[model samples]
Target: MPNVKSAEKRMRTNEVRAERNRQFRSRLRTALKKVRAATTAADATPAFREAASLLDRAARKRIIHPNKAARAKSRLTVKIAALG
Candidate 1:
């Protein structure tokens, strides 16, 4: 129970932000999965780009750690490249 008014407001803001971040994270995972499942270089390149973009956005927004974002992007790129 937040005693102060500001604390209560902050709690509400946190709930909204948490939900937004969860959505972003879920989208990020789905994009990465699409990239990974791409069988051809043609199919993979765009999916990889989209996944990378999502990861960068999530990292910039502080939803995920920068190092984690970089690692995921790196691994996905490698997977895409190896498809050829």
Candidate 2:
């Protein structure tokens, strides 16, 4: 426990932010999984779009690196192409 009042408040805010980041990361993973689980290109298109949007959002928020998001999008594109 922090002896300072501001320190306690900071800790509380940090915990909330951490939880929010964790949930967003979880959503990103689920979105990626949905894209991978898709069997057909038509089926994957929408999932891929959703996953890409989530990835971009996460990257923009600095939850994940921008390069990581770009790489993932490229790989997903490849998978979609192969399916077609």
Candidate 3:
């Protein structure tokens, strides 16, 4: 438990931020899954674009590492190419 008033406030703010980060992470995972599940290159293209956008946003916000986002985007692009 936070002993000081300021510490308590910080704890509350941290909890709020954690929840928001969780939501962003969940959305990112869903977007990646959608792209990977796509059966055709045409279907995957839109999903990949959306996932890439989400990855960039998440990386910019520090929810995920920038290199991790880049790696995911690269792997997804490869998968899409393989689908063709």
- Candidate 3, which ten residues in sequence have the lowest lDDT sum? 2-11
Candidate 1 local lDDT, residue 36:
84
Cα-based lDDT for every prediction: 0.91, 0.98, 0.97
User: Per-residue lDDT for 1-84 in model 3, tens only?
Assistant: 979999999999999999999999999999999999999999999999999999999999999999999999999999999998
Give the TM-score comparing model 3 with the true structure, all chains together.
0.96
Candidate 2, poorest ten consecutive residues by summed lDDT: 31-40
Candidate 1, poorest ten consecutive residues by summed lDDT: 75-84
User: Stretches of candidate 3 above 4 Å error?
Assistant: none
TM-score winner, 1 or 2: 2
Which lDDT tens digits does candidate 2 get at residues 33-73? 99999999999999999999999999999999999999999
- Tens digit of per-residue lDDT, candidate 1, span 9-81: 9999999999999898999999998988888989999998898999999889999899999999899878877
